[model samples]
Target: MAYYISSFISPFGMILINILDGGEEPALKLTTEVLTGHVAVYHGDQIWRVEANPDWSLGETAQALSDLAFEAEIPEELRTLGIAALQNCVSDLYRRQPFVTA
Candidate 1:
């Protein structure tokens, strides 16, 4: 599995992680939109559209993941792994971005 990580540090410090098992740039790019408050998930061999909450909080993100896991019957351990993957991706992205010191 490969992950593309990006971070936008304006208005709010936000991190975006695009997780893909196959070489699907489109899926990775689509995941970027999720940072702007959109939800795209794999469903039945196709990507499904999901409504994102206006408030972008860790809890909100976790809940979204939980919902997806429930719908897809993903194992709890896998769900935790997914969240950890995302968290690691985001943290690395944040670390890479230049820090502004004033």
Candidate 2:
């Protein structure tokens, strides 16, 4: 169970992605540019069978996780573990991209 988030930052904004490593689930993405942001969670392998536009908020990251829990009818504890795992992954990524101003 691993999480991967890669970011592409630009002068305008950034594109954040969440991709699975050892799973079959499609990746999740949050993109921003100027005044608008988009959140999408993909479903399916051969093709995208489902799509979602979760509320645009940083908290939506966790909210999306909870939503998945409900949708998949998984146990309460799995949501907790999943969110924690994602947080750790983000922290690791941030470490590699430490902030700097120019």
Candidate 3:
């Protein structure tokens, strides 16, 4: 069971972030749709796996994109997308914690 957090179109493709099985961290999945052959994945705040399609995973490109986000070096137009995705994921996880109070 994965909880979808956010998604956005980028140079790479349609990037989506989700929490896998109620996990605390987010998993990033890159998809190019029917237009191209790009695909990748991001997990554990790192590049968990990446490879060519139809195999699913996040590679170096996705890692670089996230790195730029963390370093605040992503282009102005794309800035905040990744950061917001991460923030949203964490916020949702925190809210789900048993000890959390209203």
Candidate 4:
């Protein structure tokens, strides 16, 4: 029953991946691009995609999370954990604002 999030920040934005159950068999995974609002959810052998929304609003990350979760066709049994992962990623991206190196 282990759950964790891994995030990678880039100049463009941040990419977040959520792993469950030590990533063993029957693992659950969700990934999102924070700035782009693009999402992917995995359960068993199938992956579901939530397209990136063109609308951009730094203040609306939570809204974006809901929209992404709503759009994803993730299995009902895995939905809660999957969405939680997405939420964690969004929060991480918001807390660690992107920086530009000169």
Candidate 5:
């Protein structure tokens, strides 16, 4: 089970945050779609587009999850669970991408 949090900085540098619960199949599906859309809008056809490795560290993932939890007004215990889930996902992703270090 995993969760994800995303923040997009606009062209003017304004930030919009979205928190996703990836544990559920439906949620995971939706998150992937949303993330894909985000990437397409933000990075597609841009000279700045760069395929950087996703190497989010545990601390960074935890912090992102915490912020998401707070924003979503989820219970503290559930938020902790979400953080753990995100950490596990990040670890797995890191392993899959051998070059990425977390």
Candidate 6:
């Protein structure tokens, strides 16, 4: 199962974000309503979107997005959106993880 999060726009188009929950196989059905057990990104309007496996860490997703942020395929005008999404997810993980800073 998974949770539908927010979506971000890129030069290519909208990049939908989904948070995977429980251990259920994805159905790949698209909808505007947020639900569980799926990580489907509606790409009817755009060709690219960041997606994570059921076992992948959001940190990994953030890293993947970070890496994609610099790809030649990504337009300069919208590069920051992907990077910002990655940073936002990373920042959320940072605050959620247990850590001690000096």
Q: Sort every candidate by lDDT, greatest first.
A: 4, 1, 3, 2, 6, 5
Report lDDT per candidate.
0.44, 0.40, 0.42, 0.53, 0.36, 0.38
Residue-level lDDT tens digits of model 1 in 1-102: 444433232223233434444554423322324445655444235554456766665434544644554465444443455556555644554466545221
lDDT (Cα, tens digit) per residue for candidate 4, span 1-102: 455545443334344445556656446555555554565556678766666554544324344445555666665545676556556655656567654321
TM-score of each: 0.42, 0.34, 0.31, 0.50, 0.37, 0.40
Per-residue alpha-carbon lDDT of candidate 6 for residues 29-100, written as tens digits (9 for 90 to 100): 122122332223322234334444445444544455455446425344345443554466456545765451
Q: Which residue pairs in candidate 1 collide?
A: none
lDDT of 1: 0.44
**Candidate 3 lDDT, 1-102, residue by residue in tens:** 334445543332235554333556554432233344444344445542333343332233344445545544223333344456644543454466535321
lDDT, model 5: 0.36
| TM-score rank order | 4, 1, 6, 5, 2, 3
Distance from true location, Cα of 84 in model 6, Å:
2.5
Clashing pairs in 4: none
Candidate with best lDDT: 4
Runs off by more than 4 Å, candidate 1:
1-15, 20-37, 43-45, 73-81, 90-102
Clashes of each: 0, 0, 4, 0, 0, 2
Error of 3 at 78 (Å): 1.9
Clashing pairs in 6: 1-37, 2-37
Model 4: per-residue Cα lDDT at residue 16: 45
> What is the per-residue lDDT of model 2 for residues 65-88, given as tens digits with 9 covering 90 to 100?
335434543334443444455455
Looking at candidate 5, what is the lDDT of residue 82? 45
RMSD of each: 6.3, 7.4, 13.7, 5.4, 11.7, 12.2
Candidate whose TM-score is highest: 4
